[model samples]
Target: MGDIALTTLGQDIMARLDEAARFSEPGPGVTRFFLTPEHRQVADLVRRWMEEAGLAVHMDAAGTVVGRLEGPAPDAPTLIVGSHVDTVREGGKYDGMLGVVMPIVCAQEIRRSGTALPYALEIVAFGDEEGARFPTTLIGSRALSGLFDPATLDLADRAGVTLGQAFADFGLDPAGIPALKRDPEKTLGYVEVHIEQGPVLEAEDLPVGVVTAITGIERHTVAFTGKASHAGTTPMETRRDALAGAAQAIAAVERIARETDDLVGTVGSILMEPNVINVIPARCELGVELRSPERGIRETARRTVLESCEEIARARGLGFEHTLGYEEDGAACSPRIVAALKEAVEADGYRPRELFSGAGHDGLAMSALTDIGMLFVRCRDGLSHHPDEHIAEEDADAGARVLLSFLTRFGTPRP
Candidate 1:
């Protein structure tokens, strides 16, 4: 693609994204959630775009929209590219929507140019990634990965409507969800184009980067219990204050992260008893989360942090306990796909940069279905899930051209 054509392609994609943003509820920012009327309209609009691009389109039982383009050869494994279409409470336009439109435009260009491909192509727009509607997230992609738990259908939204009911309202059968999983033998791999959602690419002055891995995450709760006493009566040297022990643990958490490389630990929430300032706090509960691309590093950091907390509690004469709430193992990008994406970016006349994804994405769930690869375009100031989130037109052009080149040269299987 020429420079002028690339700009035009980017402009078209941005315009489409702007159109999608219009379906949001009346609010400060985009607030479209899964199973809402807004989601239905947006899915229809995306399906229309896919049809216009000369692909067969359908909305799966999970409300995920997919478009298919067949290759010349029969029985060839299909190449899959996609991202989620659902948004957070006030998400920006480029977060998940960009990935969907980028490939649609590229597939349209390939159709117009009559280009040949080594395999079939499928573009997917996943629904329900943000968990904006229900207590669960990633329902669409997880279903594709055979990770969807059927019990989640019993879960209800704020309106008390069950997921199964929502499916019925959308004219889909809940029983069909299990069949949405694609066979690995007939699939090539999955590719996603997403905003960096962080400052790494912008700081490095690169428009795009190859995703090395989606960082694994572990969350645990730490609670300390001590005898409550009158603040005025308790002496500083004699009191066993749980809040004081928790304070030390929180500080250690920060220091632990600062001392470690590529590791982030956060104590996002704290709840302590004895609301009155006149009384010493008897118990304190904290929510801690740790993330890192390397499992061993993350696990080690987690153990050290927890052990430090326990030691602080023992020193303060407080009962200490912790429980691992949830854990998701990290998913490394396929070496083959990573090399191809890096090569694609290098072909676009810039240095290829590699980084790990700090945020969760559909790619993490889809990794179970097939080999996964991701390309990240830089967002301004690392802002995402906010109205101010943005990417430059030139950056979009770079991402588009790189992806265009990637799809064009993906590979040919031997007869």
Candidate 2:
């Protein structure tokens, strides 16, 4: 098999992507979260694909599916390729699914091309990358990285169902979580192919983005409290409007983020207590997410934002409180993986640009414990997490080819 064979593999991978896209709402967008029926259905489909590719398969108690091409030496380290299959609310068809399917396509191509690799190849499709239902992130990758703990199992969704319950409902055993942790010593490296979910590649007219670092994320839930009073009765000077104080704090967060080159802060969600039209808000709750490639910048911006909010609350005679939410440490790709991607891109005749992710991912979690790398494909109009999010089929296919080439080089170990 040669370059033409790779084009055939690309077409096959895209066909699978389209099939998965059809499983959910086709045009409007796809929505599949962890432990949901859609999630299970997709997982089953991926497993069948793995079987067709002639790989041994298994799903850990945490619901991560692994398809293994045994290495000649069973004890030798393994090269793992995977990304989550779950989608965010009204998410695009390609975001996480590309990462999941690309490895399978590559595995099939490797088998056909008779490429020999030094290490074993394991294709994985993680369960929950979106965390749309649980309000937590990277559940599947965290389990593999040994970062998951009892507390994680006890975490409840918005519906008040524990993660254990969700696992149980999905026909997985929650008590066997200890077995889910992958031994870092047995792992060679990890690679993932995913849509950029941003506009960097499109803006640069590049088809592929080799990730430099996964941005650090800091999440905070802030609450502002004040006396609830009639809007008309509260005098302009004496009134302690919680919403007013929150607005000022939100503005401060934006200012701090804009002060740095890579820092970004967003107050995307907010709620006003006792939301009566004529009443001054008694309390206001807002969620702030700050991200930066540099940890120092992230910490500094978060601290500055918190301090500014406190000051605003004190001056305005309101009570201010904030609690730290989820955090993902930034990860820089392994030099070996980066170089390989560069070679693969050039070999495939596509220009490559170094990029950083503003959002967190399963790869970020895996990066904590092992050598992990990521690739980003372009998204249409830079939109994501919305029904209108999209990616061109040709671009998606291009990403798969680059990924398949990288995986072919990594080659699976025969068990």
Candidate 3:
């Protein structure tokens, strides 16, 4: 595509992104979760765009909206491209939206050129990747990979609605989820385009990069229990405060993360029983999360953090409990797809840089089903999941050009 054409396509993508932002809930920033009314509206809009691009569109039982453009041969394997459409509460506009919009624009541009590749192309707008509404992430892609647990159907949201009930409310049959699974034999690979949620690309002064692997994640809920005491009457040395133990644990998490290379841990949430200025808390609940690119290192960090929490509680004379909530192994990009992405980036007149993704993406789950590759577009200050997240039109254009280049040259079958 010519520079002028690329510019026009970039503008179109931005316009569509703005349109999708309108479907968000009432807030200072965007917030659209799984199977909600906002999700349905976004799905309908994407389906229309897919149709206009001359691709056949369908919504699977998992609420994934897929747009298919068949290859010349009917039995040829397919190359899937897409990202999640769901957003975190008060999230930025470009995080997942760019991935979905850029691919649709690529497909439309390819169709206009009247060219067909050896493999079919499919664009998927995943229904739930944030897990903002529910507690589980990658619900859409995991279902496609046949990794979704049936027990999750019974999981309920804050509104007391089960996932199965949510599916029914959305006019989808939960029993049909099995049929949505893709055959690995028939899939070439999965490619995702997304904004770099960190500052590395910007620091390197690069607009695009190839992702090497996604970080592994482990989450837990920790509780510290202690006897309540009068805040004014209790002597400082005699107090066995649950909140004090929790504060030490939180500090330990930060200290560990800072000491370990490529390891990041967070104590994102904390709750205290009898949360008052005048009362010493009887109990404290905390949410702990750890992520690292290396599985062994991540596990070690988790263990260390848990051990520190226990020590803090024991020293403070408080009871402690740690319960594992969720875990996902880090996923490495396929070497074959990585080579293709590097070539695409080089062909686009920029030196290809390889980096690890700090945040989780649909590609992490899809890697179990097919080889996965990711193209990262630089965002301002490496910021994402916030209203301030941003990407320049030139950067978006560069990303689209790379995707077009990759599609044009990718012809080898999955071995």
Residue 358, candidate 2: Cα error in Å is 1.8
Worst 10-residue lDDT window for candidate 2 reads: 1-10
lDDT of 3 by residue, 1-415 (tens): 2444555777788888888999999997789999999999999999998998899999999999999999879998999999989999999889898999999999998998987788999999999999999878798898889988878999999999999999999999978887778999999999999999999999999999999889998999999998798999999998989998999999999999999988899999999998988999999999999998789989899889989998998889999998999988899999988999999999999989999898889998899999999999999998888988899888888999999999988975546
TM-score of 3: 0.87
Query: Candidate 2: lDDT over CA atoms?
Result: 0.83
Kindly indicate the candidate among 1 and 3 with the higher lDDT. Answer: 3
Model 2, span 1-415: residue lDDT tens: 2354445655776778888876663446898888978888888899998998889998888788889998768796888888888887777678888888878877877776787667888888888888788867687788788877767777888899988889899999867766677888898778888878788899989888898778988889999999888888778898889998999988898888788788889999999988898998899999999988789888888888988999999999999899998887788788878878887888789887888888878878888678988888888888887767777767777887888777766533324
What is candidate 1's lDDT per residue for 10-31, written digit by digit as tens? 8878888899999898887788
Model 1 segments beyond 4 Å from truth?
1-7, 413-415
- The Cα local distance difference test for each model comes to 0.90, 0.83, 0.91
Query: Alpha carbon lDDT of residue 170, candidate 1?
Result: 86
Q: List the candidates' TM-scores in order.
A: 0.96, 0.86, 0.87
TM-score (C-alpha) between model 2 and the true structure: 0.86
Q: For model 1, state the Cα shift of residue 237 in Å.
A: 0.4
Tell me the lDDT of model 1 at 104.
93
- Which one is best on TM-score? 1
